[model samples]
Target chain A: DAGVTQSPTHLIKTRGQHVTLRCSPISGHKSVSWYQQVLGQGPQFIFQYYEKEERGRGNFPDRFSARQFPNYSSELNVNALLLGDSALYLCASSADSFSYNSPLHFGNGTRLTVT
Target chain B: QQQVKQSPQSLIVQKGGISIINCAYENTAFDYFPWYQQFPGKGPALLIAIRPDVSEKKEGRFTISFNKSAKQFSLHIMDSQPGDSATYFCAAEDDKIIFGKGTRLHILP
Candidate 1:
Protein backbone atom coordinates (compact mmCIF):
# COMPACT_ATOMS: atom_id res chain seq x y z
CA ASP A 1 0.00 0.00 0.00
CA ALA A 2 1.16 3.50 -0.73
CA GLY A 3 1.92 5.92 2.10
CA VAL A 4 1.16 9.60 2.09
CA THR A 5 2.18 11.39 -1.12
CA GLN A 6 2.90 15.05 -1.87
CA SER A 7 3.19 16.93 -5.13
CA PRO A 8 5.72 19.46 -6.39
CA THR A 9 8.67 17.82 -4.71
CA HIS A 10 10.60 21.09 -4.93
CA LEU A 11 9.53 24.64 -5.66
CA ILE A 12 11.29 28.00 -5.95
CA LYS A 13 9.30 31.20 -5.71
CA THR A 14 10.18 34.87 -5.43
CA ARG A 15 9.40 36.87 -2.34
CA GLY A 16 5.78 38.12 -2.05
CA GLN A 17 4.54 35.33 -4.33
CA HIS A 18 2.06 32.68 -3.37
CA VAL A 19 2.46 28.90 -3.37
CA THR A 20 0.24 25.93 -2.88
CA LEU A 21 1.46 22.50 -1.83
CA ARG A 22 -0.71 19.45 -2.24
CA CYS A 23 -0.94 16.21 -0.28
CA SER A 24 -2.79 12.92 -0.64
CA PRO A 25 -3.45 10.88 2.43
CA ILE A 26 -3.09 7.16 2.64
CA SER A 27 -6.10 5.09 1.69
CA GLY A 28 -8.81 4.94 4.35
CA HIS A 29 -7.34 7.81 6.29
CA LYS A 30 -9.61 10.67 7.24
CA SER A 31 -7.29 13.11 8.98
CA VAL A 32 -4.61 15.27 7.38
CA SER A 33 -2.18 17.69 8.98
CA TRP A 34 0.47 20.09 7.67
CA TYR A 35 3.86 20.98 9.16
CA GLN A 36 6.74 23.25 8.30
CA GLN A 37 10.33 22.16 8.93
CA VAL A 38 13.05 24.75 8.67
CA LEU A 39 16.57 23.62 7.94
CA GLY A 40 18.23 21.97 10.94
CA GLN A 41 15.01 22.04 12.92
CA GLY A 42 12.12 19.71 13.67
CA PRO A 43 8.71 19.87 12.03
CA GLN A 44 6.28 22.43 13.47
CA PHE A 45 2.55 21.91 13.36
CA ILE A 46 0.62 24.28 11.10
CA PHE A 47 -2.91 23.05 10.45
CA GLN A 48 -4.99 19.93 10.71
CA TYR A 49 -8.20 18.86 8.98
CA TYR A 50 -10.50 15.90 9.46
CA GLU A 51 -13.41 14.83 7.34
CA LYS A 52 -13.05 18.02 5.34
CA GLU A 53 -13.47 20.16 8.43
CA GLU A 54 -10.93 22.41 10.08
CA ARG A 55 -10.06 20.73 13.35
CA GLY A 56 -7.00 22.55 14.65
CA ARG A 57 -4.56 25.28 13.72
CA GLY A 58 -1.14 26.29 15.00
CA ASN A 59 0.35 29.71 15.72
CA PHE A 60 0.93 30.50 12.08
CA PRO A 61 -0.32 33.77 10.65
CA ASP A 62 -3.36 34.23 8.46
CA ARG A 63 -1.16 34.04 5.38
CA PHE A 64 -0.98 30.28 5.97
CA SER A 65 -4.17 28.37 5.24
CA ALA A 66 -5.20 24.82 4.41
CA ARG A 67 -8.21 22.81 3.37
CA GLN A 68 -9.04 19.15 3.06
CA PHE A 69 -11.19 17.76 0.29
CA PRO A 70 -13.99 15.32 0.76
CA ASN A 71 -11.75 12.62 -0.60
CA TYR A 72 -9.28 13.26 2.23
CA SER A 73 -6.64 15.04 0.18
CA SER A 74 -5.25 18.35 1.49
CA GLU A 75 -3.74 21.54 0.18
CA LEU A 76 -1.54 23.98 2.08
CA ASN A 77 -1.48 27.51 0.71
CA VAL A 78 0.90 30.21 1.80
CA ASN A 79 0.37 33.78 0.62
CA ALA A 80 2.92 36.59 0.19
CA LEU A 81 5.68 34.14 0.89
CA LEU A 82 8.73 35.52 2.62
CA LEU A 83 12.24 34.22 2.50
CA GLY A 84 11.64 32.88 5.97
CA ASP A 85 8.76 30.83 4.55
CA SER A 86 11.24 28.71 2.68
CA ALA A 87 11.29 25.28 4.24
CA LEU A 88 10.25 21.68 3.80
CA TYR A 89 6.48 21.47 3.97
CA LEU A 90 5.32 18.13 5.27
CA CYS A 91 1.92 16.45 5.11
CA ALA A 92 0.85 13.76 7.54
CA SER A 93 -2.27 11.62 7.71
CA SER A 94 -3.88 9.48 10.33
CA ALA A 95 -7.00 7.38 10.77
CA ASP A 96 -8.80 10.08 12.69
CA SER A 97 -8.33 13.32 14.51
CA PHE A 98 -9.53 11.97 17.85
CA SER A 99 -6.81 9.34 17.83
CA TYR A 100 -3.99 11.81 18.03
CA ASN A 101 -1.84 9.17 19.65
CA SER A 102 -1.98 7.07 16.53
CA PRO A 103 1.32 7.65 14.79
CA LEU A 104 1.15 9.96 11.77
CA HIS A 105 2.50 8.76 8.45
CA PHE A 106 4.31 11.47 6.49
CA GLY A 107 4.94 12.11 2.86
CA ASN A 108 8.27 12.95 1.25
CA GLY A 109 7.36 16.64 1.69
CA THR A 110 7.51 19.62 -0.64
CA ARG A 111 10.69 21.67 -0.41
CA LEU A 112 9.80 25.34 -0.87
CA THR A 113 12.45 27.98 -1.44
CA VAL A 114 11.51 31.65 -1.44
CA THR A 115 14.13 33.59 -3.29
CA GLN B 1 6.71 28.73 26.18
CA GLN B 2 8.25 25.75 24.49
CA GLN B 3 6.10 22.79 25.38
CA VAL B 4 8.80 20.29 24.56
CA LYS B 5 12.58 20.75 24.75
CA GLN B 6 15.20 18.30 23.42
CA SER B 7 18.98 18.00 23.57
CA PRO B 8 21.78 17.77 22.62
CA GLN B 9 21.66 19.67 19.37
CA SER B 10 24.05 17.14 17.86
CA LEU B 11 25.74 13.91 18.91
CA ILE B 12 28.59 11.81 17.62
CA VAL B 13 29.02 8.20 18.70
CA GLN B 14 31.18 5.29 17.66
CA LYS B 15 29.58 2.33 15.99
CA GLY B 16 28.01 -0.16 18.40
CA GLY B 17 27.89 2.52 21.07
CA ILE B 18 24.71 3.65 22.73
CA SER B 19 23.30 7.08 21.79
CA ILE B 20 20.87 8.80 24.09
CA ILE B 21 18.64 11.83 23.41
CA ASN B 22 16.63 13.45 26.12
CA CYS B 23 13.42 15.51 26.07
CA ALA B 24 11.36 17.34 28.67
CA TYR B 25 7.78 18.52 28.28
CA GLU B 26 5.80 21.09 30.26
CA ASN B 27 2.23 20.03 29.64
CA THR B 28 0.71 17.64 32.14
CA ALA B 29 -2.03 16.90 29.65
CA PHE B 30 0.45 15.20 27.37
CA ASP B 31 -0.16 11.47 27.65
CA TYR B 32 1.53 10.24 24.50
CA PHE B 33 5.15 10.72 23.53
CA PRO B 34 6.62 9.70 20.20
CA TRP B 35 10.05 9.81 18.61
CA TYR B 36 10.46 10.49 14.91
CA GLN B 37 13.44 9.84 12.65
CA GLN B 38 14.09 11.93 9.58
CA PHE B 39 16.73 11.54 6.97
CA PRO B 40 18.02 14.24 4.65
CA GLY B 41 15.51 15.12 1.92
CA LYS B 42 12.82 13.04 3.56
CA GLY B 43 10.00 13.50 6.04
CA PRO B 44 10.04 12.36 9.62
CA ALA B 45 8.92 8.79 10.32
CA LEU B 46 7.74 7.28 13.51
CA LEU B 47 10.52 5.34 15.16
CA ILE B 48 8.95 4.31 18.43
CA ALA B 49 6.49 5.71 20.93
CA ILE B 50 5.51 5.40 24.59
CA ARG B 51 2.61 6.33 26.78
CA PRO B 52 2.90 7.95 30.17
CA ASP B 53 1.57 4.78 31.73
CA VAL B 54 4.57 2.75 30.58
CA SER B 55 8.06 3.27 31.84
CA GLU B 56 9.70 1.91 28.70
CA LYS B 57 9.05 0.49 25.26
CA LYS B 58 11.58 -1.22 23.04
CA GLU B 59 11.71 -1.98 19.34
CA GLY B 60 14.82 -3.58 17.94
CA ARG B 61 17.78 -1.36 18.86
CA PHE B 62 15.51 1.63 19.61
CA THR B 63 13.95 2.15 22.99
CA ILE B 64 11.79 4.85 24.57
CA SER B 65 12.06 5.61 28.28
CA PHE B 66 9.28 7.62 29.82
CA ASN B 67 9.00 9.37 33.17
CA LYS B 68 5.57 10.59 34.12
CA SER B 69 6.47 12.31 37.35
CA ALA B 70 9.41 14.28 36.02
CA LYS B 71 7.70 14.87 32.68
CA GLN B 72 10.89 13.80 30.98
CA PHE B 73 11.55 11.08 28.43
CA SER B 74 14.41 9.81 26.30
CA LEU B 75 15.32 7.66 23.35
CA HIS B 76 18.16 5.13 23.68
CA ILE B 77 19.71 3.53 20.62
CA MET B 78 21.79 0.47 21.36
CA ASP B 79 24.38 -1.05 19.04
CA SER B 80 24.03 1.89 16.76
CA GLN B 81 25.14 1.69 13.16
CA PRO B 82 25.97 4.17 10.43
CA GLY B 83 22.58 3.73 8.85
CA ASP B 84 21.03 5.07 12.06
CA SER B 85 22.61 8.46 11.56
CA ALA B 86 19.84 11.04 11.09
CA THR B 87 17.84 13.73 12.83
CA TYR B 88 15.77 12.46 15.76
CA PHE B 89 12.85 14.46 17.08
CA CYS B 90 10.86 13.88 20.24
CA ALA B 91 7.26 15.07 20.40
CA ALA B 92 4.62 15.46 23.07
CA GLU B 93 0.93 15.15 22.19
CA ASP B 94 -1.98 16.64 24.04
CA ASP B 95 -4.79 18.26 22.05
CA LYS B 96 -2.03 19.19 19.59
CA ILE B 97 1.39 17.77 18.92
CA ILE B 98 4.48 19.78 19.91
CA PHE B 99 7.94 18.80 18.73
CA GLY B 100 11.43 19.42 20.01
CA LYS B 101 14.16 21.16 18.06
CA GLY B 102 15.58 17.71 17.12
CA THR B 103 18.99 16.10 17.59
CA ARG B 104 21.31 15.22 14.75
CA LEU B 105 22.87 11.86 15.55
CA HIS B 106 25.88 10.52 13.69
CA ILE B 107 27.20 7.05 14.34
CA LEU B 108 30.66 6.70 12.91
CA PRO B 109 32.27 3.39 12.18
Candidate 2:
Protein backbone atom coordinates (compact mmCIF):
# COMPACT_ATOMS: atom_id res chain seq x y z
CA ASP A 1 0.00 0.00 0.00
CA ALA A 2 1.21 3.45 -0.84
CA GLY A 3 2.07 5.76 2.04
CA VAL A 4 1.05 9.38 2.31
CA THR A 5 2.16 11.31 -0.79
CA GLN A 6 2.67 15.06 -1.19
CA SER A 7 3.01 17.13 -4.34
CA PRO A 8 5.46 19.75 -5.59
CA THR A 9 8.33 18.32 -3.53
CA HIS A 10 10.07 21.69 -3.89
CA LEU A 11 8.62 25.16 -4.27
CA ILE A 12 10.11 28.62 -4.34
CA LYS A 13 8.05 31.78 -4.00
CA THR A 14 8.45 35.43 -3.13
CA ARG A 15 7.20 37.31 -0.13
CA GLY A 16 3.54 38.32 -0.34
CA GLN A 17 2.87 35.49 -2.75
CA HIS A 18 0.47 32.63 -2.15
CA VAL A 19 1.24 28.91 -2.40
CA THR A 20 -0.74 25.71 -2.23
CA LEU A 21 0.57 22.26 -1.24
CA ARG A 22 -1.29 19.05 -1.79
CA CYS A 23 -1.42 15.70 0.02
CA SER A 24 -2.94 12.29 -0.68
CA PRO A 25 -3.45 10.12 2.37
CA ILE A 26 -2.92 6.42 2.60
CA SER A 27 -5.75 4.26 1.40
CA GLY A 28 -8.42 3.54 4.06
CA HIS A 29 -7.30 6.39 6.26
CA LYS A 30 -9.86 8.97 7.36
CA SER A 31 -7.70 11.60 9.04
CA VAL A 32 -5.23 14.06 7.59
CA SER A 33 -3.08 16.67 9.36
CA TRP A 34 -0.62 19.36 8.32
CA TYR A 35 2.61 20.44 9.99
CA GLN A 36 5.38 22.98 9.41
CA GLN A 37 8.97 22.02 10.13
CA VAL A 38 11.52 24.78 10.29
CA LEU A 39 15.13 23.90 9.60
CA GLY A 40 16.72 22.30 12.67
CA GLN A 41 13.34 22.08 14.41
CA GLY A 42 10.68 19.46 14.83
CA PRO A 43 7.40 19.64 13.01
CA GLN A 44 4.69 21.84 14.50
CA PHE A 45 1.05 21.04 14.04
CA ILE A 46 -1.03 23.34 11.86
CA PHE A 47 -4.39 21.74 11.18
CA GLN A 48 -6.06 18.38 11.45
CA TYR A 49 -9.06 17.16 9.50
CA TYR A 50 -10.98 13.99 10.25
CA GLU A 51 -13.80 12.71 8.14
CA LYS A 52 -13.48 15.93 6.15
CA GLU A 53 -14.14 18.15 9.16
CA GLU A 54 -11.79 20.36 11.10
CA ARG A 55 -11.03 18.49 14.30
CA GLY A 56 -8.02 20.30 15.65
CA ARG A 57 -5.99 23.45 15.04
CA GLY A 58 -2.58 24.70 16.07
CA ASN A 59 -1.13 28.15 16.87
CA PHE A 60 -0.49 29.07 13.25
CA PRO A 61 -1.73 32.40 11.87
CA ASP A 62 -4.92 32.94 9.92
CA ARG A 63 -2.83 33.10 6.76
CA PHE A 64 -2.61 29.32 6.96
CA SER A 65 -5.65 27.27 6.09
CA ALA A 66 -6.39 23.73 5.01
CA ARG A 67 -9.29 21.63 3.81
CA GLN A 68 -9.85 17.92 3.36
CA PHE A 69 -11.70 16.49 0.42
CA PRO A 70 -14.24 13.72 0.40
CA ASN A 71 -11.64 11.47 -1.10
CA TYR A 72 -9.47 12.05 2.01
CA SER A 73 -6.90 14.14 0.19
CA SER A 74 -5.93 17.52 1.60
CA GLU A 75 -4.55 20.89 0.52
CA LEU A 76 -2.67 23.43 2.62
CA ASN A 77 -2.65 27.07 1.56
CA VAL A 78 -0.51 29.90 2.79
CA ASN A 79 -1.39 33.48 1.89
CA ALA A 80 0.84 36.52 1.93
CA LEU A 81 3.85 34.36 2.54
CA LEU A 82 6.88 35.75 4.30
CA LEU A 83 10.48 34.62 4.66
CA GLY A 84 9.48 33.16 8.02
CA ASP A 85 7.12 30.89 6.12
CA SER A 86 9.98 29.10 4.46
CA ALA A 87 10.00 25.54 5.77
CA LEU A 88 9.09 21.95 5.00
CA TYR A 89 5.34 21.38 5.00
CA LEU A 90 4.47 17.86 6.09
CA CYS A 91 1.25 15.92 5.75
CA ALA A 92 0.29 13.04 8.05
CA SER A 93 -2.52 10.53 8.00
CA SER A 94 -4.01 8.04 10.40
CA ALA A 95 -6.87 5.62 10.65
CA ASP A 96 -8.87 8.19 12.62
CA SER A 97 -8.58 11.22 14.89
CA PHE A 98 -9.14 11.90 18.61
CA SER A 99 -7.93 8.38 19.23
CA TYR A 100 -4.62 8.99 20.90
CA ASN A 101 -3.40 5.51 20.11
CA SER A 102 -3.69 5.97 16.36
CA PRO A 103 -0.18 6.51 15.12
CA LEU A 104 0.54 9.08 12.39
CA HIS A 105 2.07 8.21 9.02
CA PHE A 106 3.82 11.13 7.33
CA GLY A 107 4.81 12.18 3.84
CA ASN A 108 8.31 13.23 2.79
CA GLY A 109 6.97 16.82 2.85
CA THR A 110 7.03 19.75 0.46
CA ARG A 111 10.02 22.00 0.85
CA LEU A 112 8.87 25.63 0.61
CA THR A 113 11.43 28.36 0.30
CA VAL A 114 10.16 31.92 0.39
CA THR A 115 12.51 34.42 -1.19
CA GLN B 1 2.87 23.91 29.88
CA GLN B 2 2.56 22.57 26.38
CA GLN B 3 6.24 22.36 25.72
CA VAL B 4 8.24 19.13 25.45
CA LYS B 5 11.91 19.80 26.13
CA GLN B 6 14.55 17.57 24.55
CA SER B 7 18.25 17.61 25.27
CA PRO B 8 21.53 17.15 23.39
CA GLN B 9 20.47 18.85 20.14
CA SER B 10 22.88 16.40 18.50
CA LEU B 11 24.56 13.09 19.34
CA ILE B 12 27.38 10.90 18.10
CA VAL B 13 27.77 7.29 19.15
CA GLN B 14 30.02 4.41 18.18
CA LYS B 15 28.51 1.40 16.54
CA GLY B 16 27.13 -1.19 19.01
CA GLY B 17 27.07 1.49 21.71
CA ILE B 18 24.09 2.98 23.47
CA SER B 19 22.56 6.29 22.40
CA ILE B 20 20.24 8.02 24.80
CA ILE B 21 18.12 11.14 24.30
CA ASN B 22 16.08 12.72 27.06
CA CYS B 23 12.90 14.78 26.94
CA ALA B 24 10.86 16.59 29.55
CA TYR B 25 7.24 17.48 29.00
CA GLU B 26 5.24 20.02 30.98
CA ASN B 27 1.76 18.84 30.17
CA THR B 28 0.72 16.02 32.45
CA ALA B 29 -2.51 15.67 30.56
CA PHE B 30 -0.60 14.18 27.65
CA ASP B 31 -1.55 10.52 27.74
CA TYR B 32 0.90 9.30 25.15
CA PHE B 33 4.59 9.75 24.44
CA PRO B 34 6.00 8.62 21.12
CA TRP B 35 9.41 8.73 19.49
CA TYR B 36 9.91 9.30 15.77
CA GLN B 37 12.88 8.94 13.47
CA GLN B 38 13.38 10.94 10.29
CA PHE B 39 15.97 10.63 7.56
CA PRO B 40 17.07 13.11 4.94
CA GLY B 41 14.35 13.87 2.39
CA LYS B 42 11.89 11.73 4.32
CA GLY B 43 9.18 12.26 6.89
CA PRO B 44 9.43 11.09 10.46
CA ALA B 45 8.54 7.49 11.13
CA LEU B 46 7.18 6.16 14.40
CA LEU B 47 9.89 4.41 16.32
CA ILE B 48 8.32 3.48 19.64
CA ALA B 49 5.70 4.83 21.99
CA ILE B 50 4.56 4.42 25.56
CA ARG B 51 1.48 5.47 27.51
CA PRO B 52 1.44 7.17 30.86
CA ASP B 53 0.34 4.00 32.58
CA VAL B 54 3.49 2.18 31.57
CA SER B 55 6.95 2.93 32.88
CA GLU B 56 8.75 1.42 29.92
CA LYS B 57 8.29 -0.15 26.53
CA LYS B 58 10.82 -1.82 24.32
CA GLU B 59 10.87 -2.79 20.67
CA GLY B 60 13.86 -4.42 19.08
CA ARG B 61 16.85 -2.22 19.94
CA PHE B 62 14.75 0.85 20.85
CA THR B 63 13.27 1.50 24.28
CA ILE B 64 11.21 4.29 25.81
CA SER B 65 11.51 4.96 29.51
CA PHE B 66 8.80 7.14 30.98
CA ASN B 67 8.70 8.74 34.40
CA LYS B 68 5.27 10.20 35.01
CA SER B 69 6.05 11.79 38.35
CA ALA B 70 9.12 13.42 36.93
CA LYS B 71 7.39 14.41 33.71
CA GLN B 72 10.36 13.03 31.81
CA PHE B 73 11.06 10.36 29.19
CA SER B 74 14.01 9.15 27.22
CA LEU B 75 14.76 7.06 24.19
CA HIS B 76 17.42 4.37 24.48
CA ILE B 77 18.91 2.90 21.33
CA MET B 78 20.94 -0.20 22.10
CA ASP B 79 23.37 -1.70 19.63
CA SER B 80 23.28 1.58 17.74
CA GLN B 81 24.11 1.22 14.08
CA PRO B 82 24.93 3.64 11.30
CA GLY B 83 21.51 2.91 9.88
CA ASP B 84 20.07 4.56 12.98
CA SER B 85 21.64 7.90 12.11
CA ALA B 86 18.84 10.44 11.74
CA THR B 87 16.88 13.11 13.53
CA TYR B 88 14.79 11.81 16.41
CA PHE B 89 11.79 13.60 17.86
CA CYS B 90 9.92 13.05 21.11
CA ALA B 91 6.22 13.81 20.96
CA ALA B 92 3.30 14.11 23.33
CA GLU B 93 -0.11 13.24 21.98
CA ASP B 94 -3.55 14.40 22.99
CA ASP B 95 -5.90 15.26 20.14
CA LYS B 96 -2.80 16.22 18.20
CA ILE B 97 0.93 15.65 18.56
CA ILE B 98 3.36 18.11 20.15
CA PHE B 99 6.93 17.40 18.99
CA GLY B 100 10.23 18.26 20.60
CA LYS B 101 12.88 20.34 18.85
CA GLY B 102 14.52 17.10 17.65
CA THR B 103 17.88 15.39 18.26
CA ARG B 104 20.20 14.61 15.37
CA LEU B 105 21.93 11.30 16.05
CA HIS B 106 24.93 10.19 14.03
CA ILE B 107 26.12 6.65 14.65
CA LEU B 108 29.69 5.96 13.62
CA PRO B 109 30.28 3.02 11.35
What lDDT would each prediction earn against the true structure?
0.93, 0.94
Could you give candidate 1's per-residue lDDT for residues A72-97 as a string of tens digits? Answer: 99999999999999999999999978
Model 1, position A22: C-alpha lDDT score: 100
**What's model 1's lDDT at A80?**
97
What lDDT tens digits, residue by residue, belong to model 2 across residues A1-115?
9999999999999999999999999999999999999999999999999999999999989999999999999999999999999999999999979545478999999999999
Measured against the true structure, the TM-scores of the candidates, in listed sequence, are 0.97, 0.98
What is the C-alpha lDDT profile of model 2 across B7-108, one tens digit per residue?
889999999999999999987789989999999999999999999999999999999999999999999999999999999999998777899999999999
How far is B70's C-alpha from truth in model 2 (Å)? 0.2
DockQ of all models, two decimals each:
0.75, 0.81
Tell me how far the alpha carbon of residue A82 in candidate 2 is from the true structure, in angstroms, after superposition: 0.6
